[model samples]
Target: MHSLGFEPNEITYGSVLSACTAFQVPIFGKQVYSLAMKNGFFSNGYVRAGMIDLFSKNCSFEDALRVFHDVFCENVVCWNAIISGAVKNGENRVALDLFHEMCCGSFLPNSYTFSSILGACAALEELDVGKGVQGWVIKCGAGDVFVETAIVDLYAKCGLMGEAVEEFLQMPIRNVVSWTTVISGFVQTDDSTCALKFFKDMRELGVEINNYTVTSVVTACAKLAMIEEAIQVHSWILKAGFYSDAAVGAALINMYSKIGEFDLSMLVFKDVGSLKNPVVWVAMISASAQNQNPGEALEIFRKMLQESLRLDKFCISSLLSVIGCLNLGRQIHCYTLKTGLVSDVSVGSALLTTYSKSGSLEESHKVFEQILERDNVSWASMIAGFAEHGCADQAIKLFGEMLLEEIVPDQMTLTATLTACSALRSLQKGKEIHGYALRIGVGKDVVVGGALVTMYSKCGTLELAKSVFDMLPQKDQVARSSLISGYAQNGYIEKALMLFFDMLMADLAIDSFTVSSVLGAIALLNRSDIGTQMHALIAKMGLDSDISVGSSLVTMYSKCGSIEECRKAFDQIEKPDLIGWTAMIVSYAQHGKGTEALRLYDLMRKEGIKPDSVTFVGVLSACSHNGLVEEAYIHLNSMAKDHGIEPGYRHYACMIDLLGRSGRLKEAESFINDIPIKPDALVWGTLLAACKVHGDIELGKLAAKKVMELEPCDAGAYVSFSNICADVGQWEEVLKIRSLMKGTGVKKEPGWSFV
Candidate 1:
């Protein structure tokens, strides 16, 4: 047309500018703007509005504003164009400011103008300003479905769910977008029930629910973990012929995985016609990881690699998490490096955590250092890695550095730092972190609260733990169990029992950890009846086979003197982990079944269960009880050589008892001296008691002296030494010890025996 010598009018220029905006061709839009200026048609209102829209859509806010200010006669279209342009460019605050400026003009805002302004308010989550705009929209009769939906979105994003729902109900008409927006808002607010109800109502009203609406509904089902509702949504999706929709497919996979319906998740994954969709693949990988099928997740990852599918950071991160095999994790890391995603923050963080979980903190820290744009997750992963690896000081140091960098720690970061504090038992440092959490408004976050409770509990401050527990708005199972365990550990048996009952009455879901905690409390209370009842409850809940629950049941029954019940619980665990094996071993040792305990220990090793420090304690105790002196020494040496577990104080105490009970006083004394750690009171007490039993008069005096040095005037130490002297016919020595006790005001209480 240009070559034919037809002169372009304002309408042609406006049409070209609108086309440029639609195609997001800013350079061509500028060329059109130039042509309009050359023809003296630049100031045409329609052309000017088109230019502004074109520039804004291209994110040229400066150019858009220039056109807006240069418009010779600004109308609502020009103003709305600039306002909407500002919003499109993510200059929401600027958009709101422009609306204020527009309000000062002679031209009043039309529905389009109001809609743009409401959108600005919603983007900013400015509830007060949104309300004002909403009122203006109502007064001007501009509250159409579009504007009404924006209002609902604004309220929902601001956490005013009631106001959002009220506005949704008041809307005179609704479209597919409006319905989807409201449902998504409810889902965002974590009101899955409300979101589902709205979806149901929308379907009953014969409103067409599109793929976006189905996706949101599926998300709500996933959040609620309601398998039935998820299946229902899945059916609706199938009926709507949207089963192949990527978002709906991904959501269904996530929902089924979260509900523990692995078969259904696989079906959804298989139904996704485009396995090439990275998002759907990511959802499947994440689902496998969440469902504790790490090998399957790796298989999916391998399949993705085999098909040459591009893996996103999310997919890499999910696979990194569950690939606990160190070699596999390193292989993934190498692949990430090859893909040039090693520097990606999410992947870097996941790699750090994966290496840490694989017991390679050095590699974890290397990955942490390689991440340039470290976000909250990156910092959190490093801190948690150090904490989990028992590098408390390093974790705390990193946390402090993170703060100094002015990065706000999220809940996970705080939880990791609190865990470090718990490891160090630094009560003061823990208090400082608690203060920080309160300042940062994550004090009541479920995970953070649970960490605080555990930190305080482990620090021997049950009152503070309970106080933190009480302050939590929602008592998560971890928080409840931590407080209950604290109470039980501190001998507040009744308080622990009461809290457990309260948790049950509140209908909080009882997980394995909670069941174990309550059973331990019952054991401490010596309530055999309650223990029996708890056993029944465990069986009823189908938790009897859970390893931790079964182990706790064994300990509980053993402590309550029900060895048969303890054995029964032990026999119930088809494949006991180290804890279950250790529990049974300790139970047998306590019941004078040393041979059985040692046999179980040998079997545990044969089953490839590596014995930890606790298991070593049980084994050593068994040897000590049966007077297997040489066997005890051999086992103690094997603790470090075979298992890489060093002899702790408990192990040393057991060794001393083994030697002393077998009348080997000299060797017991030498073993105490050879202990790597500073021997505590238990060590000295064991030797002192052994001295009395074996009639070693001189060694008894030395052992008593060591005990007194450690315990500072222990009456039992004085009495034992005096008895040794009396047995040796050293009347003078006995009198001296008695006088020393009298002078020191260490009164010996009358001995009593339960049996």
Candidate 2:
């Protein structure tokens, strides 16, 4: 019209501005605004409302407000437009303020005004404000389907699902939006059964479902783990021609994965046929990882990269979850950095976790430090990394810093910090955290409760641990296992066994850790009969082949004097890892079958399993028991040369015992002196015990002196020295040793036998 030289009027400008707002053409809308201003159309309410909406929808809130103030007379259309625009711009509080100001003036709120204001209340989760708005909605007689749906949404978002449902039932006419709102509300509130029931009612009522409804139904099925319901929902989605919807497809993929139907998730992925949809790809990748198909997840990620799909934070986080090696993790981390996605907290936290899991704490810390906006997840991941890697001090310190920064610790953060406290045996810190947990209202949370039990157990406060366990509202597997393990660790073996029996009687799920803890208790009791029964249960439960369970069985049988059964259990492990191999070797060593232990160690090496420090301890113990001095020397050298494992104090003690058994007393003393690290009291005490066995009076005196120097209050050292003096007829020295023990207030510990 302008090109044809037709002068634009207020009506024409208003129509064009509405078109601009509809198309989201803010630049063109600005030009139209100038034309409307030049034509003096700002006085027209239609043009003014259109301009406010155009600017507000396009994130030009200042311009929208300017236009609102430019008009001399305030009208309801302009008021609704400005308030709705404020909401669209994410200025929820501003929208509320504008609504209050409009209410104090001449204009009363309409249905459209109520809808927008209720949306602001929903966004803010302001239940009180929403209730007030609902009252106003009724008093003004502005309650329509749109306003009612918004009210339902406000109640739902505020977690008042009962009120939302009650309001929904009162609606004389409900649309698809109303049904979807209530159904999705149930899903959001974690009432998946109610969500499913509502969906059923909707379908029976012949209410049409949209993609969001289908997505919500799928989520509900996933949460319930109702695979049949999920399948039915999938079929309905297909029939409704909503199968290609990205959100619905993602929800279906996640639902299938949650129900352990990875194949179905893959089928949905293939059928979606829209690789461009990042949500679908992310869901598939996450599903594969969640189902423990990391290789497949990585393969899907590679295909995603091949398709030139832009990687979002969720996509990056999902891909990071599947990374099994430091190299792969670094590759993804580098990709995130180049894409500037590393700045995203989710991606950064995922990279931190990936690096930590791959055994690169330095890289994990680096990523954590580089996260510009660290949330609870980033802090929790780093703390867990430090705890898992035995950097307990660092984890605790980081947790303290997190608190000082006033970042509220979530359940994972608290759990990880408790784990760090467990590892460090920091009882005071643990108790403080427990108090903090109660203060924050998560003390009764199951995960945190389990961590508390483990923490108190590890700190040797079994009573406190048991108290926490008893206070738990619902004891799950983790809490039960933690309490059981705590009992075993703190010498409350009978209590551990009783709890295991209670779990069995209750038919609670018995995982490998629970069985392992029970086996450990049985091992301490040397109850082969109980161990045998446990083995039977293990086989019945199809857990005999689990590596952790197998290791526990080996230790239990070995301690119970069932070496033959230990060997059989070891053989049952389909592919024994390092822990399994080490357990068998240690079991054989304990049984004095040193040659058998050596042979098994060789077999372990042949199977390409590299030995760790504990493996070497078992190897050295076998040599020590067998008096294989030459073999001990060779293995000790190989520990540093071949495996890059430094021989710890236990290895040194074993070597010294081997030399002393061979009557190479001089060689043993030289070995202790030559140890690169200072031998602790255990190493010296081992030598003193050897001297007592050999009746080497002079060497015994020197070894006892060293042990006393390293541990002055050790009554065992004093007793051993006194016994050595008595054997050599050194009466004067024996008397002096007894006097020294009296002066130091040392007393020999009474010996006991498990049998």
Candidate 3:
């Protein structure tokens, strides 16, 4: 009106102030207020109330309060503006004080005043104050739908679900906001069941739900992890066109991800297409990480970065986890530094974990020390890092330091410390930690309990391990696997089999580790009946494609003397890794199929899978068994020259056995002398056996003497020397050998057959 040269009246100024408040343009509102003051229109009670509303909505509570006091109008509208603004600005206590002063003064509280005060009570979590406000609403007869909704939300926020429900039921009329408030309150309080029930009630009453109500219902289903209910909610979302909303889409993605439905999560994300925001991206990235697809997760992270999207702490932390690529982690660390997020404890903890899990222990320690202030998560990350890397002593030492600092260790910390104890087999320390856990009331934590079971089992106390397992409140997959592994590792094959069958009967989802543990027991027993049964189960469960399960299957079949089944298991792997390749090669070599073993080795190389130390050992053993001395020597030299795999004792032993069995005793002796490291007893034993085989008595005596000097208690060495002497009719030497054996107290092991 001023721009058009029309004299602006009080109504025009009031309308402009309200617009400024709604748009949160306080600077413009201030200028407009100045203009109104010059025009002598600012004294109007309506214009003053608009100014108070403007300042309050702009988070300028002091300004709003000044406007309220400067006008000195006994107007309730101005009072309501200042009160609601205080609550909006996070000054809940101040808002309550202002409301009290208003009530004690000439002004009577209105519906807006009651609504604002109730909100303040919710923010403060002052249930008693909120209840007083509820009584005030009742007495004032100002309980409109908005005020009543505020009352219900306050009760729910304070965890008084019964009161919240009573208030909701008493509402004379319900609107979308009122229904949404109750549902949101329940979801926030973790009462998803109640939240769903209320949502159903609201729907049956013909009340309409907006985007927020639908989102809350979806979140409730997510909390329940109820796939069927989630599907029904998803259908509602589609029919109601809620799927296009960013928050609802993100919620759907997260819900499906938690339910182990990755494909559905991706589908929801894809359906959002160009509408995807940071929330959707974070949900998808988190889904991939949780689903064990670290590679895919990283790819999505890269795409997000390429799009120039900003990353928050949650996004960075999620990416840091499950990031197998060290270079990428370093890049993310640099980004965090650039964004000044490294100072954030959560991001710092994630960085500490990433470096540790990536096998950079020194870097992990450096990150740990750089953190200015460490929380429990930071301390836990460092301790868990040390534990996972086999630095049990360091892990324990750091844990002690953490305790000395009075940092309360959570369940994760206790679990990590127990894992370290298990690795060190420090039963005494493990017991002390267990006592601490019980004292701290975390003894029943599923992860901590599982760790304790593993610790006891590894420390050679299987009975204690079983006791802990039995006492666990809930035996999750980890606990079951821990006990099963203990039994399998300690030669209790029958017990392991019994527990595995029991687990199956209970309808527990058998994971790769569980299957692997059971397969190990079957292998140790050499029972093809059980082994074949497991193999069939593996196929049925679609676990034949899993690398660990596949490898165990191969070994179990080979040990049971079913070479065909072993090959079949090997062939089932579409793209075998180094471990799978090595397992198959060893299976062939053990069965005396040296030719097939060599062929597999070549095929593995053709597939571009670099051979590790174990792979080389298998091929060398095959060549030695087939008496291919030249081939064995070529591969052994290539191991160090081409692959940079320095030949270890096993490789040298294989070479010695190869030449000695081929009657090349001199070459075997020369090879032993050429070994870079000191030859161990196994190396000398191979050479001595070859000496006896080739009838080189002098060389055989030298090798026998060296073996005795290396390991005097080696029964195989003494036996070989005795047999060589007897074959040569050296009676005096034979008597001397017998005397040596008797004096040394060395006894040969009693052999047993596996029928």
- Give per-residue CA lDDT, model 1, range 1-755, as digits (tens): 77899998878988988888888888988888898898898678888988988888775678888888875556677888888888887789889888888788788998888778888888878889988988998788877877888888888888888888888888889888888988998888888998988888998999987888988888898843587777777787888889877878888898888777888899878889265787788788888878778787778778878878887777788667656678778888989899989998889999998888877999999999999778898999899989998899999999999999999998999999999999999999999999999998899999999999999988999989989998999888899888888888788888888998998898888899888888888998788999999999899999999999999999999999999999999988867998999999999998988889999998988999988999888888999889887888899999999889888888898888888878888888888887889998889888989989878887887888888989976898998889888887999998999899989899988879769
60-143 in candidate 3: lDDT tens per residue?
Answer: 778888887886777787788788889887879899888888878889888888888999999889989888888878887889
Cα distance off (Å), candidate 2, residue 347:
1.9
Backbone clash count for every predicted candidate, in the order shown:
0, 0, 0
**Which is the winner by lDDT between candidate 2 and candidate 3?**
2
Flag regions of model 1 displaced more than 4 Å: 1-147, 150-173, 182-211, 214-275, 290-292, 440-453, 462-480, 501-515, 533-546, 572-575, 666-681, 709-711, 743-745, 752-755
Highest lDDT among the candidates is held by which one? 2
lDDT score, candidate 2? 0.90
Candidate 3 accuracy as TM-score: 0.70
Q: Which stretches of candidate 3 lie over 4 Å from their true place?
A: 1-246, 252-277, 281-309, 504-509, 540-542, 573-575, 608-610, 630-634, 637-645, 750-755
lDDT of model number 3: 0.87
Give the range where candidate 1 is weakest over 10 consecutive residues by summed lDDT: 223-232
CA lDDT of every candidate: 0.87, 0.90, 0.87
lDDT of 2 by residue, 434-458 (tens): 9999999999999999999999999
